[model samples]
Target chain A: MKKIIALLLAAAMMVVAAGCGGEQSASSGSGSGSGGKQITMGFSQIGAESEWRTANTESIKQAAKDAGINLQFSDAQQKQENQIKAIRSFIAQGVDIIAFVPIVETGWDTVLKEAKDAKIPVIVVDRDVKVSDDSLYVAKIGTDSVKEGNNVFKWIDEYMAKEKKTPRDGGSQYNVVVLEGTVGSSVAIRRQEGFKDAMAKSANAGKYNLLASQTGEFTRQKGQEVMESFLKSYGPKIDILFAHNDDMALGAIQAIEKAGLKPGKDITIISIDGVKGMFQAMIDGKANCTVECNPLQGPLLMETAKKILAGEKVEKLVYVDEGVFPADVAAKTLPERKY
Target chain B: MDMLKKFAGSSLFLPVVALLVLLVFNTIFVDGFLSIQLTEDGRLYGRLVDILNRSCSLIILALGMTFVIATSGIDISVGAVVAISAAVVCTMIGGRGDGVAQMPMALAVLAAIGVGVLCGMWNGLLVAKFKIQAVVATLILMTAGRGVAQLMTEGQIITVYYKPFEYIAGFLPGMPLPTNIFIALAMVLLVAVLMKKTSIGLFVQSVGINATAARYAGINVTLVIFLVYAFSGLCAGVSGLIESSLIRAADANNAGLNMEMDAILAVALGGTLLSGGKFYIGGSVIGAITIQTLTTTMYALGVSADQLPVVKAIAVVIICLIQSKKAQEMFDAWKARRMSKQNGKKTSVDGKVAEQA
Candidate 1:
């Protein structure tokens, strides 16, 4: 019994030593003492499960470095509970600022209130959280999903007019099939309504038909599967394919090609989210248009954090300026696309 | 009365009744739910067809799950195995623009399934040889499998544009149903025949009931367990093919998310006990369709996607209660009380008259 107790004591000491060893290296890498009284910020990231998210993480890290802020990072790996736990840890550590991209929109009330009580400002990025108190987060930085949706349809109208196939001019009738984002997600619902509302306002609203729209869940594979079903069900009548994100559009390109149709020529594809892959697709002439949702909100996020620290009242909701990039313009913008 | 008692006594009874109830509910609440129309292209259309079509992947998984659970072992890695299989096949196809296969489809498919078989063998090795708990052993792959899939696809969704590949999941020329349906049926039949015709099924039951006893009885218990896990892996492989083919791409992140739970639930809903022993593959197949029907019914009821899970959970709990032994006991007690009450009054009146005389 004496020997066993001694061994356990040794094990506990070893764990403590190992933990200190890890912290020393991490702090040195982030360069803590080079700046004067460096502002420590704890960021809880929703894991890099996709290319867009990876870019988002990189952008945030790069921005923190440029500003010389001590950034504490945690990855939630797509779970709300983990994000909440990370937020609690930030509170315990007494960081100057807490920032996160929420995995979901609900169940954040208690955590936000706790952060508020701790007197540390929380900044939300990429996604929104539902808290009854508006001051839970100093500022929300995200894309206007509905606006992005509207931009894509507007681009489609321009593309049609350039092709001398304007339905408004009584040129031809067209059918559209929509590939939506994750079902019941804010982005999916808003994007679906945005484009539909745009089309309804078009001069040839009655001439153009909304064939079918199904949730692709904003993933490439489901995008392809849903597109395959659309092809089988609607067949040659589908002229316009509007996807909520570029991932789905890229997936649908495969299905359209498999069906022996030239995606850009035979079926015009319009998508949102200006990921680099979409730029490549645009250059390849497989994708027709992409409205940028710009995943690189890190610099702006930090900027807002600084302003809040300086005691300036920042906008409660900060809308990132975005653009619609057509296939013709993709070549020029391909070299400059941030995400 | 004897027939009714026998029918109720069978393990298949509850699952069949659950399916019937769902069907009746859909037919009543969902308009044109029972209608099956033939499309101009010789394909079947309607919600019923859709249910069967969608349930194909789940059916394949549950079929394998049925065997694993029968051995008192659980394999949660089947879903991960699916992602790996999809990754291998799609990357092997190496389709570029429009997903045209650069390589031969047969070789790609065989290699994918081969990987699946190997994964199963690994699970078998851990469970049967290393003596690790099945759940713990399979959990290793369940967490790591997606990562492996991501590695194969280079963190991208690998799309296959190969036309012949579509025949695996999509409808064939002049066929009214998807080819996957036929594949699922064939797998069920093959497994059913193999289990019933040979002594393997009995051997599995013995091992599950008591491994030491089965060993004393001269049964190769280790081999039986290994073979069942290996078979489960193969089922997952075939399921992966159908799933990836359905989408014509392999999505590492979302390929078969939460599918293991669905497969396990199907097995339980089919009336298989979690503790192991006698199993029914047909009941599991029907259970898979029942799950699909529930989803379709929810959609028909205009339940929002976020709220659908809550509704499904409540319904599942109710169905589970109905299937429980406790519920059966309570029901039997009620019946006995009513019968005894009717006879007691008559006997008491007759005794009074006799006494008076």
Candidate 2:
């Protein structure tokens, strides 16, 4: 009986191993059978934590299909360890290229070094990584948050000038309040610095006084609460409201309406991240403007990957082009927004 | 004086005093903090109203948490359960372009609550039947519930545009206050009656005190534990409804995020023992209000967002110290020592007078 059981166990192991081997060979065969050499790329995503992320993932998947690249995808579910595991597995699978949206800025040196040893070029997408050696990854593709922030104040200056709403030489000061994003985040810190820089450089810099700035934690609820207190403290004296992201601006709009004041008219509302909800708010005349932080980087990433595989020189830093969406254009552009 | 002492000795005392202290600080430091104005739409608009309005959900969560803690069990899954409930309701009432609910509002709400109760039953099964640790059992749901919610929403944040649906968190026609305040009040009253009129409360206390002893006393320990968790799920469901309605969207990632910690903290601030037995619903309600008031005060003062948590922690520590029984006992001992010293001084004075005579 013992000998029979051992034979059965050995037969089961052979069948499982044969199944895996068949799958491996079939995948490789299909990869080579395509019109030309198909580039096999493994991409690790951070997770679908927000609409922006989901749209970003969709763009990558669709782009990979359009580019005829064999894409091996894994979701890290917002964990760095999971991302590292995915990268190691991709190395074992010996994919031609590896790309990932690093969940954090640090702790990728070892795994990335392993990928380099395997001769698999790595592309860092969306969020960046801080590896000891820059050669660990071939390229980084993401939006410049500081530039997005600078664009916010620049557009505000242009809008005010166009509307002739800029404060006169001796007119009452324009009190501005800011609804910041999650504290200590890189995006938040950079955006704030950029805004401050532009504000100082603006033509009417001295005419604007910063009434208050507080963190909204990048949520609608906290944004509404903080906005409510701001209204109570500063009242209708506030002429402008700047939110670090669209969600908080949407919340502030609700609070503004509840306080019996018109949002865009009473307080010019400007925020970052041109999300669909923000566009809707703009179309409704609740918000004024949003500086776009584009998440659709699929095509750019594919082009870069093709360039890298062809032994072509690619820029180490690649930034996707973004635009500013004002209230007047929101109605026309809302339909085209994929996010 | 005796009545004051009795009032001070009650479980509700510390929470109430904490709330009052926050309110008083705001009144003194924040401009127009105590003033309430009527909006053109006839709703009350002010920071005070915001505190009450926002705290309603936390109060409801704390109410349910109170019962679960009284059974010596924690429901860390309530936050995730809130996300699940929100997802269920929002999806069932699909986001049609015409802004119409796919299903009846009442039916959608009931379905959400039903799903929550089902989740609770799963946790209860693991903890009560499988003899799993409560934290581990609830942690399973805590981790998986958000994933389940994400699946239900198809990884999208479902925004409900149905105008009538807004009344869950917003004001009804001509209403002076938010609907959530009334919902919270009704829940508190319902739970208060349940504890006062039924022997279920006693059963829960017995089970919490000692399950072995409770079983010997003819108490259905398993049923008691199961029911409390189910009740917690119910509270989470109602809270989910209020929260989703506030934003008019069901955010699977952010809805009720870290709410379990807030609920647990409120329970602790209410002077409830972590090792459960007797509990007070009113104390928890006051505790919830106090926390919201603290948040509002921080915002009112315009504290930097990065430093807000640190300031909040300091406030919570001060309140907890004030509520600590050991601190109170120590104070009493010090007072007694001073009283004895005074009496000794008086006797010595009399002895000197007698010697002079």
Candidate 3:
């Protein structure tokens, strides 16, 4: 009986091994067939933690199909260790190119060095990586939070000017209150710095009084709670409300409406991340403007990957083009928003 | 004076005093903190109302947590269960451009609560039948429940545009208070009556104090443990409905995030021991209110968001110290020493007078 059991176990192991071997050979055979040798790219994603992230993943997948790149996608489920494991596996699989959205800023030097040694070009997408050697990755493709923040101020300035109520021209002082994102996050810090820089540089800098600023942790619930207290303390004195993200702004709009005040007219609301919900809010006249930090980087990433594989020199830092969407244009753009 | 001392010695004393102190501080420093204005929509709007309105969910969560803790078990999965419930409700009521429900609204809510009770039953099965540790059992659901919710929502934030659905968390026509306040009150009353009228409370206490002993005393220990967890899941399910309705969306990632910690803290602040035995329902309710008031107070005082947690930690420490029996004993000892010192002086003076006579 013992001998028979051992034989059965050995047979099971052989069958499993054969199945894995068949899968690998079939994948490699298809990779070489097409028009020419298809470029196999292994891309590891930081999990779908939010709607914005899911849209970003969709764009990348769609772009890969459009660009005719053989994409090997792995989800890290928002863990750095899992991301590292996926990168190591990609190296072992000997993919031509490797890419990942690093969940954190640090702790990628070792796996990246391994990829560099394996002679595979690595691309960092979305959130950046901090490695000892910059040459480990060929290029970084993502949005610039600082530029997005600067654009917010510029859009507000343009909107005020268009209304013929330029604060620079000695118009009424606007009491601006801010709902910041999670404290200590790089995006939050950079966006805040960009806003402050634009404010200092503008002629109407002194007219926009910052009444209060508090962290809303970039959630609808916290945003509403904080906005409720802000409404009670500052009352109708607040003329402008700026949230670090659209979710917080959406939450604040609810609080504003509950307080028997019109959001867009009573308090000019501006926020980042032009999500679909935010566009709907704009159409409803509850929000004023949104400076998009675009998540649709699929085409750019695939194009960059093709350029690098073709041995063309590419810029190390590539910024995706984003635009400002105000209420007037929100109606036209709402239907087309893929996110 | 003795009555005052007795009141101070009660478990409810510390949380009540903490809440009063926070309210008094806000009244003194925060402008118009005490004033409640009738909005044009006929709703009462103020910091006080906001505290009550916002804390309603937490209060409900704490009510369930009180019973779970009484059984010497913790439901860390309450937060995840909340996410799952929200996902179930929101997906059932599809986000149509027109304000229409895919299914009956009542059925959707009942299904959400039913899912929550199912989750709790799974936890109860693991702990009561399999003899697994409560934390480990609940942790399984805590980790997997969010993923389940994400799957239900298809990794999307399902925004419910049904106008009538708003009344779950928002105001009904011409109502002065948010519907959530009434929902919370009804839940509390239900739990209060269950504990007062039924022997389930006593059975839970016996099982918590000693399960083997309780079984020997002809108590159904397994059933008591199972029922507490089910009740806790019911509370989380109701909370999930309120939360999802508040934002009109099922955010699988953020809905009821870290709320389990807040619920556990509320139970602790109510002077309930983690080891399980005696319990106080009203104290937990007051503790929930105190926490919300503390948060509102920090916002009103203009504390930076990064610094808010630190302030809250300090306040919690102070309240816990005030509730500590050792601290009260030390205070009584100090008072006794002062009284004895005065008596000693008088005795010495009398001795001197007797010697002179």
Candidate 4:
């Protein structure tokens, strides 16, 4: 009798779960069907692992709602296999459009080809996917990481000029310690490339020396640990810090404080990814500057989807104009910053 | 000669030799590999200090692993348990203030450790009562643990700003070394004393050697197995606290990634057989330090992060070769052959001399 009761309870619970799933899908289906020739969009996100990612997911969800477009969302949880599965499922559902932020670059050819054969257009976001066929994805929307890195150096150049400390004019020599993101990641590579390229073009190029550059793995904890070691290695000679992301910058701030130095003033910090934490740091004068890698691409993305659905030609690549945020503007813009 | 032979034949001899060899290699090839200095804050800083400091979590994990492996059982869910503990603690604290404990930090820590113990109990129940294979049973938690953490944190990285909390993994006021090192040492001493002062250690070894035989011998085999896994879970909880405090956040996905593998490797490198039996806690501690030192050395040498794993794999292979019984036997056989060949030449020379005479 107990076993029978347990089985019934389990079955009832499963029924409730299935019902909930049905209601969710049905609402989305109704939402898409309500408008004239409603376009359904299936978006595969790379899971909400960080604050930035969570904001990104929220942006897309909110954008789809505001645009009155039916959206099917899949959280891949940072796995390529899960992303591929989500994409294939979208294809099977025959959604009007398929879009995803890929976890990695490779191993998507077969799945993308499947989407291509199904006559569905796929939009890539945040991260790029490498496929043999060009038409696999209709468009890619992401910030130029190289430009972001270049902006960091440009901010430094202007700051030095304002201080009347241009290195090339026999002013002050600056020593920099770079905290890179995950090594071999395209974002990390391009950011490094852009920074180096900018440095070459800058007038203070000869006066700047790279003390030590190491991978922080794009994590705050690693950034702090790496910064701790850098402090031990370089000590007072370190003049500036260039981190790949805001999390690393935040971490380096803690490390610098622990080392008994003012982070923004003593060791000028320039990082990419203008997340709220970095903005807060800037307002507090703990971070010198940050280059924006806008996570709120949802509005623009949904707009593009609407245009694509209308049979309008779209560009192969859409570059989001992300600007650098300095300490002064951080306070005023903190209220309006979406992500 | 007799003492040297005894030392060489000890179970811990290989691990010690491996550690010494690594230290020598690092000192010779890596620049300032042995340098230690005191900063203005009076904290000891250097590659060696970094290795010791970083190895605290691994050392704690390996301590639990030593007992679990001694019972011929493995707990692969320790890493996941770490994530769960971090989530519980960070969420409880909830980033209340300027690195200040919103609630009593001690309570939050205890709650996290309690969750760890509960997780261990679940594993123990599965293995001890349900008779599920240890790996598969732990694998269930290993897969679900991170997800559980994600659920607890609502898929957001919970960054805590509590200052006192950082002391768990960071330096305390006027203290040169990290508090984690002391905590790890205390755990080792506690476990070591328990094994030494009681019959529990012998029962665990007997059960691991032969469960059926031990049951017949009147040992509480199930109880021993259960306690071992529960203990492993507790160690994972401690490691979770240290890790979360160190990072000042609860990152469910990345907190303890691949840590179980490292713990298992440390145990194996410590000369504890995966098949189970006699175990050494001290050896496991040293083994954890060795792994950390290798990582620090790689980083110091400026090896690109992508290539560090390749170098680590090659070093792991070399260490395994040194530890394998088959390789030892082959080496012995080669040495015997060389000795025999020299003897043969000696005899031939004597024969020629005789002929000349």
Candidate 5:
């Protein structure tokens, strides 16, 4: 008990010291305001996991450098604890504005409260953190994962029609093998629910169906393995492959190739996250379609940061632009791609 | 009935029975489940090869665990050891480079093994020196070791770029077989030779059977305990190397996570006495395959995720009962009565003949 108390006292002291230091930094911040004045922008990333994350990190770094803003970067590494720690650190840093990609929907009450306590405006990007009150964040900028799923299905309907294959329910439904994202993740859960809802509500209900839905954890290997099993147990049964993310979709494609089968021609593959790999997959005619989930949050976040720091009213939610891209256009759009 | 009553040394029967039941159940209830494809591609897709690949790591974990269990010690930290080795290999080795540039892989492998040994030694010191329970000591290292692995890579996966390291989990030339499977098989034979063909194996078993008796017999009990944990670390280090190669990246959180459960379950199902004494290398190998097959089939048949634990629990429970005292007693008593009845008739006849004489 004494040891715990001592630890708590130490932690309290650290927090107070950090808070004081943050105040000092905020007073002498460096960022580009209206007249080229130095300002500060705090950014928190949802920890690194893959090449995509590295790209994200680089994008933000370059953005911060080019914008001449003092970027207070925090790598959460996909942990709520670490993310919370970073947020608290940002609060102590007292940057003019804050931006972060939330790892999960919940568990932001305490840290957001800290941000609120610090009187700093927060901008949400990539992923949204669930809060009881929307007043917590100044603006939220991200793609609609549900609409992404809808777009995939919409393309699938056209693809199936061109293939002249009757849906399993005799043109009423098409059986789908769904590779879901991590369980309890907002993207995975919502995207799955959204796709299910869209498929059910589509005009040709018999043209869309669900065979099996499993968590691939948004990895290529898991996606490949799951796809293989689906092929085994439900051979000739799965008509379409629906992945919650591009990574799993890519994995499924690998599994398909390993099986000595063509992916797009045999089984329709549709996914979100218009990553370069997905575009390459489209260009090679492996993946059928993709829904773009923009990763570049610099401009949108910067805009929100400026507004919040300037004491101007910003919209509570800012849905970023997102749309479906067919394989036909992949080659044409490859050069213009920035992600 | 009397013939059916024998089960003392038999360990494979229950696990096999449960496995068969699950297979049959799936064949019946799961839709299109009988679509059993015998093609090489089909089996490969079904995880036959992947399971074999995973078998090497599992066997290493089991081999290490065997000595630990034989000495009445347990190490829950092998899972975290996997993460540590993977991170070391990925970050230290500099990933996917030429032979000279791939020095980090070799260094990482050595570091991982060294680290694993150190972890085992730490556990050993706690159990042999400070008299801590093996379970508690290992559990502490389990959490802390994972924390260490996460700290090493800063929670980022460093993708391996070297082709040589890829061959660790990739394939053997021309055989279309994973290299890890062969490695695991070689380790199994090595473990078997170590335990059965050597005095050290007997010494460990004797110590486990009765530590006091072993001590009176002049056996160094503490040394044996320490040896067991260190051996466990070596096994975990090998497993970590294979696993890192498979993913081509050192993901601290996911690599070798929940592996301890699989290893423990494999050891238990192998009928190795968890309390200590007598290792079953063959049984452990079979147990690993059986569990892998069951997992593969379950996922293949579209088993609902919510009900996996329940099914696993029920299967485990049934297997335990089949090999339990209650079931054995019922069979034993029946056999005893039948044998006694036949013997009574024979003895009466013999007695009558003796009276006539």
Candidate 6:
């Protein structure tokens, strides 16, 4: 009878230990957890799609380290289903805050609502989600993707304006082509729309036409293939190649060399996502312009979290600042340009 | 006439018919998609060539898989074997140009084949020696193989330095054909010759038909299972080399992703029964060709990114349905009558069946 009682006590002790472990991890991000554990944070990345994505991932890791944040990382691998699954796992884990770079802008409302109901603050970074209710996300910390596109087209138009070059003097003087990103993606839709709007609004550069717009799916191989087709069809007529992202732009540079053409002079190029490669491209005079898409989320997110915690009003839409890099300026600033 | 009817009654007839339907549909809908074309190089250009070059890998895989499945076994590890062999070749060359290219292409290919064989042997040992389920054994290797490729290349595209290596992906001058297509075709022919033309092929079919019966008859079941997997591994190596050369680099991230799935799909589409007994090498090649041609056509038509995966899924499912036994039974009945009428018109002085044909 004594042995049975002892076994029961042991089993009860194990259950208590397991419960405490579950509770500790769950409440770690609360900032009120015992023994001063830095706020626990869960991050969901939208898969490694390219070199830029890989760099974005590394930057996040570094940010987590500098801020002393317990980062629970998950790679959705470009699958919306996986992203949803990871967020649910984060909620169940009871982390203090939840953050994710959305795979697409939709299908996040239900999960975001679940996180909100749990009293866990959800922060969106890099990309924004399209939810009917704005309260589902605490604050979206991302760059102005529309302006990023407008800036690329605007820079090209401005350069042509400064050169005093007009296509009316020659036939098909600067036939520009565009490589779109993923279909139905917030970045792809907004960038394409913004670029078109800006280009159309320009009375002087309206002569510069977009000959082709095809989806590269934001992959290097597809970018190379699409660029190859454009070159073959356009021949000497093609002038500028505007890609939605830097990785595709880099791939087009390789294709240009593969096809026996000069990159910067023969085919002027511009892209978004001021990644290390884009900077390198700018420094080497292979690419013309790039709009930065900052991956650093700590300062903005931490400040917002503090405000929310302090019961002070916070900004609903927090837009990260974007800057452009020209060939001359990029060479000087290459060393200091952090992603 | 009766003999012809019996032949048509075979399970492969429906798959062949479904392939025709897809061809017709693509011809109608897809722009610039007609397979019949002549290039400046005096060779065929279009869907046929696309299929020939790409289907070679899947054909070799399916031929080997047919043997394994006959023993009521499954392998989900062929993709891993391809990755390992490709990685091995890329590492051997180490992306050195103007120097490493001096080495004989045959030696490098043989070494790649050796690496694949080693991987296959490991899989065989795990399943046969340890008494593990075929799926479980292959699954273990499948998960590890990707990591092995990543470790080999240090997670970078390791480019190779070989001129002849590029030829395996396409063809040399005067051939006007992709080397991979021929390799695949030759392998399929070899498998068909072995199984239909040789006793060992018959033995494999018999063993798959009924393992207990084959064992009772004193056939070596274990040896047959081991050999099939090993051969499948060899096919995978050849495929990896050819495919890697096409890209000019070994990208471990997407090199062999979901390839084993495609091979299985092709094998099933080619009218090869998964329950294991009989094999269909020619039909399997056709199935692989059908898949490649479909992808090429979709790309040519400028199909959007989101729509590509859905299109592929629909095509595979529809082909599988057409290859089903019920569809085959229906096709055989239709084909037999058509054959008889054609024969009647050919032999008879009257030529009445010409109108019907």
List TM-score per model, in order.
Answer: 0.70, 0.87, 0.88, 0.83, 0.76, 0.67
- Looking at model 4, give its docking quality level: acceptable
Off by over 4 Å in 6: A1-124, A127-138, A155-216, A221-292, A296-314, A322-339, B1-51, B54-56, B80-115, B147-198, B309-325, B328-357
Assess candidate 6 and give its lDDT.
0.73
The superposed Cα distance between candidate 1 and the true structure at residue B335, in angstroms, equals 6.0
Winner of 3 and 5 under DockQ: 3
lDDT of 2 by residue, A231-276 (tens): 9888768888999999899889888887888999888999999999
Q: What is the clash tally of candidate 5? A: 20
Interface RMSD of 3: 1.4
Evaluated against the true chain A, what TM-score does chain A of model 2 have?
0.86
lDDT of 1 at A182: 88
Question: Model 2 segments beyond 4 Å from truth?
Answer: A1-50, A57-99, A114-121, A166-171, A302-314, B1-5, B333-357
Q: What docking tier does model 5 reach?
A: acceptable
Give the candidates in order of TM-score, highest first: 3, 2, 4, 5, 1, 6
Worst 10 residues of 1 chain A by lDDT: A20-29
Q: Which prediction has the highest DockQ against the true structure? A: 3
Task: Kindly list the per-residue Cα lDDT of model 2 for residues B5-106, writing each as its tens digit.
Answer: 999878788888877888898999999999999877788888889999999999999998998899999999999999999999999998764689899999
Model 1 interface CAPRI class: incorrect
Which lDDT tens digits does candidate 5 get at residues B40-85?
5433333455456656787778878877887877889999998888
Off by over 4 Å in 4: A1-50, A57-123, A129-132, A163-173, A257-262, A302-313, B1-9, B324-357
Between candidates 1 and 5, the one scoring higher on lDDT is 1
* Candidate 2: pairs in clash: none
Whichever of 3 and 6 has more TM-score, that candidate is: 3
lDDT of each: 0.82, 0.87, 0.87, 0.84, 0.73, 0.73
Predicted candidate 4: what Cα RMSD to the true structure? 7.9
C-alpha RMSD between model 1 and the true structure: 10.3
Model 4, B234-299: lDDT tens digits are 999999999998778898888888999999999999988899988878889888988887777766
Clashes of each: 1, 0, 0, 3, 20, 3
Model 1: per-residue lDDT, tens digit, B1-357? 999999888878889888888889878876677877787777776667667877899999999888899999999999999999999999999756565677789998998889988999999999999999999999999999989999999887766666788889888988988899999999988888987799888998888888899999999889999999998999899999988887777888888888999999999999888899888888899889888778767755655545667899998887787778899799889877866675677765656444533
